[model samples]
Target: MSESKKFSVYLMATLPIVFWGVSFAAAKVALEEADPLLLLFLRFAISLPLLLALAWRGGEAALPTKKQALVLIFMGFMGFYFHLGIQTMAMRTSGSGMANWQMAASPAAAALMSAIFLKERMSRTGLLGALCAFLGVTVVLGLGTKGAKGISIYNFGDFLITVSMLNWAAFMVVTRWLFRDGGYPPLFTIFWEVFFAALMCAPTLALLRVDVGAAARFGAPTWEALLVLGLLCSGLAYAFWYRAAAAIPVPRLMVFQFLQPLVGVVAGYFVIGERFTPWLILGGAMIVSGVYAANSHK
Candidate 1:
């Protein structure tokens, strides 16, 4: 890519990372008043229409084959439904900032999977990076021992955040598989993914698990939070992401993501008063180093 184009790609990728990082705080705010499932529903409800507006423009059918459709549905369930639900519940207790850095294990886990299934070989530096990433996890876990009495290795929310990151890595693997043969536009694929996610989540209201009536009690801040989550975080963020992914080389594109965890820490600090602990700083640095190490082709 040309220098100007690469810069544009970086700018595009940065948009979603910024939105998603701050979104952790938005989600925390929304979760204070709404159930995770309900918050997810409202998020999609706000996000989907806008995505559809953009995704279906110019009269494109952009339909998928039955198999590809199944893949998309499966991706939605794993990526949006189950994983996001876990994240929502976790972020409620974990707070946004620490929850962000807690996800350092994802790229390392992805590297392991690539080695196992794809037969990819990791360099010594890559292996070291993975170890550093998990070492950061240990550091975070050690810090947890200091905070809450009688509980160590962090809270359930932090654990769930780690779980969500693993799910996302699996989601990425499957997405890459679909990309190999799915023959769909990125936005179109995203639309269907969100569609299936919303479809799966629709029953949350009638399931009696959540007080669907609670929506009636939502005040302005809650509404505003969901709107931003759905509109900017979910909608435009994904749009920019797909555009950037298409524009940039995969390796170069991925390197930019290391900034996300760092951004999340800052956003979390200012947005929710979560402090930057020494452990967090050290752990996050290790994780960012690992992400670059793992993603680097050379």
Candidate 2:
């Protein structure tokens, strides 16, 4: 790719990371007033129209084959329905700091899964950069013994987050598989994925007895957070992610995930009075350098 094209690809990839980074803060705000399962349902419900519209506009909105439908449904369930729902619930018990700190492991998990299943390999420099990025995120998040303990019976939420991380890794690999040889455009695939996620979540809402009526009581801030989560994070961000993942190697793209926690910390700083320290500066530099190095050509 030319310099300009590569820059655009990187920029496109960054869009979702930023949306998801701020999403931790948004979910916190919304969860203060809404049930976690309700929040998850609303996220998918609100985003569906937008995704469908986008896919339709792009002229890629054809229905999938039986096999494609199955894969897309699996993607929807694993990626959005299960992963996001579990993560949201986990945050209620464990808190966003713990969640973000644990999420820093996702990129490494993704890279490993890509290597194993997709037969993708990163160069030595890329691996080094990935390690550096991972360390940067650990510093930026200030993960300590409190949250980093290996999962025990008491750490149920932590265990759930670990599951979310692994599920995310598998989701990335499956998405790459769908797109590799020939598949629908990102928006089209994302639309169907989210469609099935929302469809599957509908029954769960009743099984869990989530009060859908609670939405009537949502305040302006709560509604605003929901809209942002739905429209931007779930809707546009997923599309942007799939697009980038389709075009870029999974391992190389996974390196960019290291910035997510840093973004979350910055978002927290502004939204919730989290402090900015010297660690932020040092860690931010390492993360940027690592992403550049990992994505650089041999």
Candidate 3:
């Protein structure tokens, strides 16, 4: 790649990770003003138009065939319903910084799943990496914000994020099975998966009977946070990610996932006052290294 192109590619790859990391802080702020369901709903709702415009500008049809539709629907449920939904709700107590740090294990979890379930060729290094990453999880669980009942409940928030991470990893592995040959553009998957996720999330408004007045009366900071959550975090970040994923080699692109947790930990400390303990360092280092090991062919 030319110098400028290389710079742009790096920028594209880095921005999404940064935005994603910062978003946990933004979500925390937005949650103070809105319920979890309401907050999540707004995110998907706001992003829908932007996604549509992107599709239109790119001259891509937004429609999916029946089989594609089924996969999209499953992705929506897993990505949005179970994954995002649980993560958002967990933030009620979990704090964004810690949650994101726990989420850093996602790629490792995916790699392990692929080895066991999909019969992928995983090196011994990959298996070792998976083991180290899971060990990190226990350390994080012990270090994270504990409940009133202490170890009995542990950090429910962190647990939820872990679940979300696994859910995401599963979606990725399944996507490989469904779209292995690069049959569709990466953008197509992002747009439609989020679209279906939004559809599935829509009914929560009726169940919650969300107060329009409260959402409307949210302070400027909260509104700004929501915009960041919807526009930058959910929408533009995904755009940048897929673009970078396409441009960069798989191994190089995969390394970028490490930045996400790093960003989250920093954001957590400054944004939400999450204490960075020694355990965090040890656990995070293990998870990051483990993910690297699992993803690396060498």
Candidate 4:
């Protein structure tokens, strides 16, 4: 490839990861003004049209069957509704850097879940890596936060983020099952997931008796953060990620994912003034290495 072309390819790969990394801080910013349910509702509601457009561009008229539709609804709820809602709530107490570090372990979680649920074989190295990742998460939970007094006494915010990580892993396994038949186009399935998730969020907000109109009074920072979360992180970043996946080798492209935590740390520091502790660095390094090792077997 020419120098310019190579640059473009690397840029394509890097941008999406940057968007996603910054998303944790963005969510933190939005959470300052709005509750988790409202934040979740705004995110999917804003991104829905963009995802719908991408799905329609595929020109696939075949929709999911009734059985598949039910499955999709469940997937939507698991992946977006509950997963994001819990994570958003977690952000109320967790630092963006800590959230990113915990989430970085999710691939290991997913690999273990796949081995157990799908009967997939895991290499010894993969098993060790999974163990290392969980240990790293424990270290983070024990040492990463400000209020935690000791290993046994953990921050509630960190605990919620850990739950979010496992929930996401389960969602991935379910998504793999849904896509295994190759009946649904990836974009189409994603669109429906966001669509159904947004639909579910509406009733949730109503149940919570949240003042949806209160969002109009939010300051510029909150709106800007929400726009970045909705438009760039959810919409364009996903589209760019899929495009990058098509162009770059999967393994080579995955190297960029490791950069996500670093980006999150930088973003958290600058955007939210989150501190960079030695323990956070040590714990995060363990997570990145473990996830890298866990995924290496594939």
Best by TM-score: 2
Q: Which RMSD does model 3 reach against the true structure?
A: 4.8
Q: Which 10-residue window in model 1 sums to the lowest lDDT?
A: 143-152
Off by over 4 Å in 2: 143-154
Please provide, for model 4 over 16-73, each residue's C-alpha lDDT reduced to its tens digit, 9 standing for 90 to 100. Answer: 8789889888898898888888998999988978887877786643477898789779
Task: Supply every candidate's count of residue pairs whose N, Cα or C atoms clash at under 3 angstroms.
Answer: 0, 0, 0, 0
Per-residue lDDT of 71 in model 3:
75
Could you tell which candidate, 2 or 4, scores higher by TM-score?
2
Model 3 Cα displacement at 169 (Å)?
1.2
> TM-score of each candidate?
0.78, 0.93, 0.75, 0.74
Best by lDDT: 2
Q: 1-298, model 1: which lDDT tens digit per residue? A: 6667766766787788778777788888898899989999888878988888888783433777798789789888988888878988887678564665655445556555655654545667756655665665555444522232222357888888888888876665555445544375678877888888998887766785778789999999999999989999889988777767555433334444555666665665566465556776686677567655654445
Candidate 2 residue-pair clash tally:
0
List clashing residue pairs in candidate 3.
Answer: none
lDDT of 2 by residue, 174-265 (tens): 88887896866788899998899889988988998888999999999999999999999998888778878888988999888888888887
Question: By the lDDT metric, which is better: model 1 or model 2?
Answer: 2
Question: Predictions ranked by lDDT, top down?
Answer: 2, 4, 3, 1
Model 4 poorest 10 in a row by lDDT = 145-154
